[model samples]
Target: MAIRNMTVATRSLDADMTVDEFKEWLRRFDTDRDGRISREELRRAMRAIRARFTGWRSRQGISYADADGDGYIDDSEVDGLIEFAQKNLGLKIVAY
Candidate 1:
């Protein structure tokens, strides 16, 4: 998946959603509207996209993956995350 000439791995989504984009996406996943995205919440949202992604959320430690701990990912890790979200999580927008 290459965006803007950046040869990156492929993921499924309308486009490569960044961690920050994912943060907002997380909000959609949190159907309960709980402000914070739990594993279960992530699972629910991911279920529509892919069942595999749920575990990655837990495996990668969502709480810690945020890096600065600002409750979001805004850097390189987005690539890995995109893979997890697409392959494991099951996103339906961008096709990798």
Candidate 2:
């Protein structure tokens, strides 16, 4: 996927991303296709949004969203990640 054009495709994800849309976008970074998001994947996602301090933020995001202490954000923990993205990454997400 072209990371540079992702923002344009999603309108920078500032307009508002539905829960499904957010998950779809995030999944693009799951390089391993493990149906889970790791710190590195999260960092890449952060970079896609042009966020600063990606390393730190990715660590923090994993810490915040890894509810099961699995070191990865799985499906059930996605809500926490969504919250982290909205609050810390300045992304607007809407549940509809």
Candidate 3:
């Protein structure tokens, strides 16, 4: 799936949630509510999104978005994760 544009992809999200809403959607994956999603948390979230990822979270999915190399996804890295999802998994983030 080719993500041609952010606007189109944003609209493709469930209920056409805005970018901020998409961020909030991802926030739910932060099980600890510490404003960050750990590697494991991200893996489970991807599964919830119906993404078919293989291997462990630390090795595959996390590496794509963990820009800071901190082993966790902070607010700054959320966009990276979004982009990864769009480009690789074709996931449309939505506020639920």
Q: What is the C-alpha lDDT of each candidate?
A: 0.50, 0.84, 0.65
Candidate 2: Cα lDDT at 81: 94
Error of 3 at 74 (Å): 0.5
Please provide, for model 3 over 19-49, each residue's C-alpha lDDT reduced to its tens digit, 9 standing for 90 to 100. 5766766776788989888877777666665
Q: Name the runs in model 3 displaced over 4 angstroms.
A: 1-16, 54-58, 93-96
Q: For all candidates, what are the clash counts?
A: 10, 0, 0
Question: Per-residue lDDT tens digits of candidate 1, residues 14-91?
Answer: 545455455455566565664655556555655555545456665464554444555544443444445555664445
Predicted model with the maximum TM-score: 2
**Runs with alpha carbons beyond 4 Å of true place in candidate 1:** 1-14, 53-96
Model 3, 30: alpha-carbon shift in Å? Answer: 0.7
User: What TM-score does candidate 1 get on C-alpha atoms?
Assistant: 0.42
Compose the digit string of candidate 2's lDDT tens values, residues 1-96: 212334523457456667887888888899999999999999988887778999999999999999889899999999999999888888888877
What is the C-alpha local distance difference test score of candidate 2?
A: 0.84
Per-prediction TM-score to the true structure, in the order listed: 0.42, 0.87, 0.68
- Give candidate 2's root-mean-square deviation (CA, Å): 4.4
Worst 10 residues of 3 by lDDT: 1-10
